[model samples]
Target chain A: MSASATPVALGAARPGLFGFTRAQAVGFLLMLAAIVVLPHVLYPIFLMRILTAALFACAFNLMIGYVGLLSFGHAAFYGMGAYVCAWTLKFWHLDAAAAILLGGLTGGLLGLALGYLAIRRSGIYFAMITLALAQMVYFFCLEAPFTGGEDGIQQVPRGTAFGIFPLHQDMAMYWLVAGIFIAGFLLIHRVIHSPFGQVLKAIRENEPRATSLGYRTMHYKLIAFVISTFLSGIAGATTSVVFGIATLDGVTSARSGDVVLTTLVGGLGTVFGPVVGAIVTTSMENYLAQFGSWVTVTQGAVFVVCVLAFRRGIVGEIAAKLRLSL
Target chain B: MSEILLETHGLTKEFNGFTAVDNVDLQVRAGTIHALIGPNGAGKTTCFNMLTKFLPPTRGRIHFKGRDITGIAPADVARLGLVRSFQISAVFPRLTALENVRLALQRARGNSFDFWRSETALRRYDNRAHQLLFDVGLTGLADTAAGLLAYGQKRALEIATTLALDPEMMLLDEPTAGMTHADVDRIVELIRSIRTGRTILMVEHNLSVVEGLCDTITVLTRGRVLAEGDYATVSRNPEVIAAYLGSDAPELAHA
Candidate 1:
């Protein structure tokens, strides 16, 4: 249509490599290098824990940010992975790779079932349904014979790497955690740039329009939910191996809160936002561990400050200001 | 060419006890510009919603290309080459203009649920998408997000996306609702240019627009069809005139 005035042109550049603009690639590379050398400088176990949490947050972002579905109970998948991985390592004595993958598969199947029910309702209804179902999974985990209730599945063998490395050394286990995190990150990146991901964004932006365009929006949402939950499950599995325990805390509402807080503080939609968020939040908890309950107070303050100061999250604000597609 | 392409029999919709549409039978012949126009609360939108399968009729049936489509989903109806544009501009605001059109083209090609492949394969659609955007006069704004586009430009984007569907028939609801004079004139040209091989059904309020563009007009009042015929014949009907401007005796004009 010929309007009196023409529209302005902004953000016309094509993104590079998996929806990351050139600037985003640079940011990602810098972060990658920092993490690669992180163990030498900081404690390997502490760094490994943060990496695991970061992967979980990134998985959560894929649902809430790209798909526009706020899942407040991501612990269902994360804890499912932890419980399965721990049980397999303790009882079945499976290899680390197989055990972690089994955990991710469990998450996928659970996501498929839960997504079928949760996606039936949207907005607050969708969130409440997921929270309620996740609580059911939590109860199952608490009462299950293998999980050991209060003690959890303790001393989960990290297991050997394809009959090779025993994964007994802390650095060796750190690499395993790092590898899983990197794999999850790359998979999410690939998915976000795929044609399927485009449909997901379309559904997010205006679902009614997308439906009118002949897309079965529900199917797209389900697939995205499965992918996100599967990745999150992997992160949880990796965490149990790193800590040698998969406690009830892993599947609790508190864990879900941690992932949500991490995603928001880092950035909701930015590709690198979750990592930044995970690092900042994990560092705060680690450094303030001596303060006991004050850690929760500090995290709440951080969330408030983040919401007040940078609603787009740190990386999101930067990406918008720079016109980069991060 | 004179055969009916879409027909509805006694289509009615009731929200609670209030009747939004009541026992309306309608038909659209192939390759004609049919306009649906009524005053506010005349059930034009409700009727259009039923035609597009956006809302189910309480007690009626819809036939599209001779297929029973009353129970079909809106997306399935579009898949059958029947497409409807929204009264509100429904472009994905965060996506770039090219990406929006590209997404429509992809859907038209039945590419939904295909996420395993890299999006680089979508580059094959670039030339056609760029052409569609260019036809809509969005030459350099391809990379701009739809939300950043001006109001008129967003409407143009909506048209381009609908056009990407390449429908045999288009159901456009208020294609020029909030446009300026210049924009309205431009959209009229677009509508005229697009109708060489496709049929169009539209809902319009601007009588001049109806008179200038529509080959046939259906006038409604209070959930019932008042008159249906060529624009000149319908406009001259005294009942149509009174129902619009307010009837003197109020005898519940034609239905």
Candidate 2:
């Protein structure tokens, strides 16, 4: 490789907490404050469920936003992680952290296999390939012996952290999930601002040019896909532990669509968009559960509005208006 | 004679039954501007594409710096010190001109996979990218997004990006195809001033620009080399003159 070093400096230093823009820091802090205080104000178990889903949405955004890939079947990895965690806890009697790690490993392996094939195509083809693969997994989960057919692996034991602290209480589980969510969120942020993330963006913007510039665009894409899936697995594993069940619902196409909806409602490419989007969408779904098919119709309307007038999503529009890269 | 930095032996490319590039041979010596000129559809761009590994040749071999590069991936070919600029501008439109050049520099340095460090800490690369922008007369527009740049400025930024690769050979396909006279002059001057110790093979439709910039010229007709020499000799060749008689050839034949 030619050692022609050229540093490109554009824009001023971002001023805020942890090198984030002011708005991003403020938004994150506000969300953190809410999560910290929500248990006292609302049902702790419900808040924990929303937080778990939010983490998954953020993980999904890591792929969709930074890598510019729309995966319609992320539920494959999420559902797989949930099943693996439930099985391990129910049979192997593993601790919570170990179960989550095992779930991440399962997701990572699947990502490696699926991403290798999915990255071979681009745009709508990539999305379709992932959806097809996820559907295959969904069928496998429904028929698999360990998954218990329709009943799934029920009454999954909520093992302790390293077999030390008890994870029996909802508050303890909430803190643990919150910690994992923040870490995963920060890791995704770090990856995006890193050189690797820049290459992904370059590939997203112009794959041909990126390839001509000597980047193995496929390799980058696969790596991003794996990381996104791994984080989604973490979220799934946490959900299985907290809720004490792993069901086929986790693997359903609707669940996959739900994550996409959350990311879209928040912002497709913006960093913190998925987090906010997850909380809002999950809360809306909870409140609208009694409305029957109207929830689906309302979600569709939101997607249409976001695509038409607010293509940038809530966070994207704000970032664009401020001339800040979120 | 200068050392040959790039050589192709009977390179051929066929799409279905039609030959896009047929039995083409090329030699580019180090540190010289070699111009490839031909009528439209005469396979000039196809030849450039093959040379850059963008299109796989149906037959024959390409030797760059004495290594067989035929059938290699385009990215690997670029890493071997060969780079090409596109006929239409190919750049990250959302990225600033400086970021585009920086990306090239990052690739050149092989540090693009570093996921832990802040991009701003890549001071050496930033300085070099800035210098490249300055060299391409785009320092003033460094912060401008490539999509927002003027037509001429976008082209200039593309050149800056190509330069950041520090290739041993540069292939420019129709570098001045859609430019005003002033923009053409600026590009020609920029190409002339680049002293990166690399050979430049350019396909140019602007005869005057090629005449002024090229050390040697190859003219093609119907995917065959009809004439090869400096401007004066090829301009007067009978076959070259006959090739120019075809309709719509005047635009490419003007000196």
Candidate 3:
């Protein structure tokens, strides 16, 4: 058992550009090219909706995918972000950037309050805790005076982003939404690859092992939860800005389920999976809306198929095929 | 005499009125290999968990480096230079072996909250991580995902990751519980190589390995210390023979 007697094969790891394998880098470029060109081929408003959903799903993935925490009430942050952003934009007359930032802050603050309690219990209990907390927020929105009871905040102004670029034009608003989506996507990517992200992965892999290595697992989980909710907040804020309305529909428990389905279909833990899943699921709802109640049935079928056929989701499967970490 | 590095006073644990570990006192000397050996349900693991602060003792005081640590958090205990490994191989299965070692070494960077900084910042630890791997005979498997490593190799990797902390003392739970003769010998050699300047307290099932490596042995049975001494002295104790060795007493004495 001498050290010299051990086998000496070099590892199979390959260097990549910007931490992405060749395949991932190519996929990223293709996705970016589509982002830029899609406005010309498709409706910009519809695309903006997809971008918001994409960002929301990516933020949700930070919990379930990276940290192995299934947050059942993520829509609480998303819906609250929308309500806050809409309130600021309509009443306070804040600029787009400020409104979105405030929305994210609201989500982060709310996440801190709920996550402190939720992370104390793990697995299904954690999920139940989050769901219960989010439901409370949903009821608060329903009864709150500022939330307009059933109507929500309507006719939200899409003012200039940073008070310079006019966001009244559909293209201008689309660009703003696109910019937010990309920046949020990269930020999530950066967090997942950072030293902090490394600890999160270790905690996700074996929590007791990480604790034995001197990591405060609770603190790490709390921080990750806040960051995730903050991102979800902005995604919600962006959606309201794009649509000019913040409705009860956005805060419904169904929205929480929708985000989960989006991420699950995209690939639960894959970096790009949530975005792909968001696009697929959001597009399905849009196209299937004519069928009314049948939309839920179709989504249920898709969820069943995805779970049974490819548990890894679309991006997870592709990454597995190519042996990449995307 | 070596200075006492870790000591326990009347350590006890009761789960729903069933006494798991009862009124056990343990003293481990600095810079020595101490083995806690006992038969099945002898409370070796329960006692180890108390020392590591994984389980709170119903009645006990633990002193490490002359400081009481019974009430401290488990992470803080590890930060105080006392680390422990699991009975089961506890590697981060998805992480590459280098990444796993680098994770332990990353603690030296302080307050692992650099979420905004790129992970390439951790590349600086590659040399030290590689060296630790080399010491544990895992250099060849550095790039392998820990889940892919063989059982013996994973145990070796666990030791390497544990060593990355450079702790003053280590508590290993069943380091070679399931290993071939060659793997056991290799681990004994590896343990010996890394024994310098650090104290090791291990719960080992293989008596022969303990005989070869441990400076002192503590034998426990049914949650109580039946005998404590050098291998030759304790193996000859009739109480130990009756309680632990039983039918294998002759072979145990020869070994």
- Over A1-326, each residue of candidate 2 has an lDDT whose tens digit, in order, gives 01111121224344344447776777778878987998898998888778788889988998887777889999999999999998999899998999998998888899999889898887799999999999999999999899998999999879798778789988888888888888888888777777787788789778888988888788898888988999888888889999899999999999899999899888877777887787778777788989988888888888888878977678767776776666
What does chain B score (TM) in every candidate?
0.94, 0.95, 0.97
Q: lDDT tens digits, residues A267-303, model 3?
A: 8877789999989998998999999999899999999
List clash counts for every candidate, in order.
0, 8, 0
Cα lDDT tens digits for candidate 1, B123-232: 88899999999898898999888989988889889889989989999999998998899999888888898898888999887776777698889988889989999977
Off by over 4 Å in 3: A1-15, B247-250
Scored by Cα lDDT, where does model 1 land?
Answer: 0.86
TM-score of chain B of 1: 0.94
Where is model 1 chain B poorest over a 10-residue stretch in terms of lDDT? B246-255
Single out the weakest 10-residue window by summed lDDT for candidate 1 chain A.
A1-10
Q: Which whole-number lDDT from 0 to 100 does residue A175 have in model 1?
A: 84
Task: Show pairs that collide, candidate 1.
Answer: none
Clashing pairs in 2: A6-B125, A6-B126, A6-B128, A6-B129, A7-B125, A7-B126, A7-B129, A8-B126
Error of 1 at A154 (Å): 0.8
CA shift at A55, candidate 2, in angstroms?
A: 1.7
Q: Score the docking of each candidate (DockQ).
A: 0.58, 0.50, 0.58
The lDDT per prediction is 0.86, 0.84, 0.89
